[model samples]
Target: MIAQIGDRLVLEGTHLGDARRIGIVVAVAHADGTPPYEVRWLDTGRTSLIFPGAEARIENRHPDETSEPAR
Candidate 1:
């Protein structure tokens, strides 16, 4: 997945009734926008490196604007 610094990452739960986790891409470790991204969680003000799974998806930084979703 390719992302910009302000993009949002949503990790869908693996099982039923599991809550979704959302985070913003704080840093792009690579110039090519590859993972292990430095993301700051929206639910909690915590940051970590994330290598996304199959359940992961991305929300564009400005949802009201005409930007594309990164995946």
Candidate 2:
């Protein structure tokens, strides 16, 4: 999936009782907003480069948005 910087990447849990992971897209590897994003995770305050899998989804950020949903 495509994503922009500041967009949130959500990786749904792979198994029962597992928690989803959320991260902000800090950098994009391609000019066309393609995959291989550099993300800073919310939980542990760590950054990683990721090629998102099937369970991942993007929550785009809009300029007019006031705030993000509760984590």
Candidate 3:
């Protein structure tokens, strides 16, 4: 994912009936938009650094828009 600061990261649950996890990217660790992103979770308002797996997707935030991911 070509994520930047303010982009939302949505982690789709692997198991059946599991809930998805959503968060905003607060910091980007590298210039190429690789992993080890610092994200702030929507549900708990907590922050964490993550290296995403196959279950994750990125929601880009346009320069002129404000976006919020689904809970």
Candidate 4:
């Protein structure tokens, strides 16, 4: 994974439940986009969360810094 900040996270849960959430990438721990992500989660009712590696989506951000999608 080589994503940047302010990007969306698309992850797959390996547990037993079926759920999904869309959040913004507030912080990036590693440059590889592997772990340690601070995201304002959307599943737990607009709360901030830190995902390890399996809970994330995409990193959709424009380099121009024009406008990002508030998803």
**Which one wins on TM-score?**
2
lDDT of 2 by residue, 1-71 (tens): 88988899999999999999999899999999999999989898899999999999999999776655565
Q: What ranking of all candidate models by lDDT puts the best one first? A: 2, 3, 1, 4
List the lowest-lDDT window of 10 residues for candidate 2: 62-71
lDDT, model 4? 0.63
Ranking of models by TM-score: 2, 3, 1, 4
Per-residue lDDT tens digits for candidate 3, residues 2-56, read 7899998999999999999999999999999988999999989999999999999
Candidate 1 Cα misplacement greater than 4 A, ranges: 63-71
What local lDDT score does residue 52 receive in model 1, on the 0 to 100 scale?
Answer: 90
How well is each residue in 1-71 modelled by candidate 4, as lDDT tens digits?
A: 55567776666666789566666677778878765677766555363556546455575677777654543
TM-scores, each model vs. reference: 0.81, 0.88, 0.86, 0.54
- Among these predicted structures, which one has the highest lDDT? 2
CA lDDT scores, all candidates in order: 0.83, 0.92, 0.90, 0.63
**Candidate 1 colliding pairs:** none
Clashes of each: 0, 0, 0, 10
Superposed Cα deviation of residue 20, candidate 2 (Å): 0.6
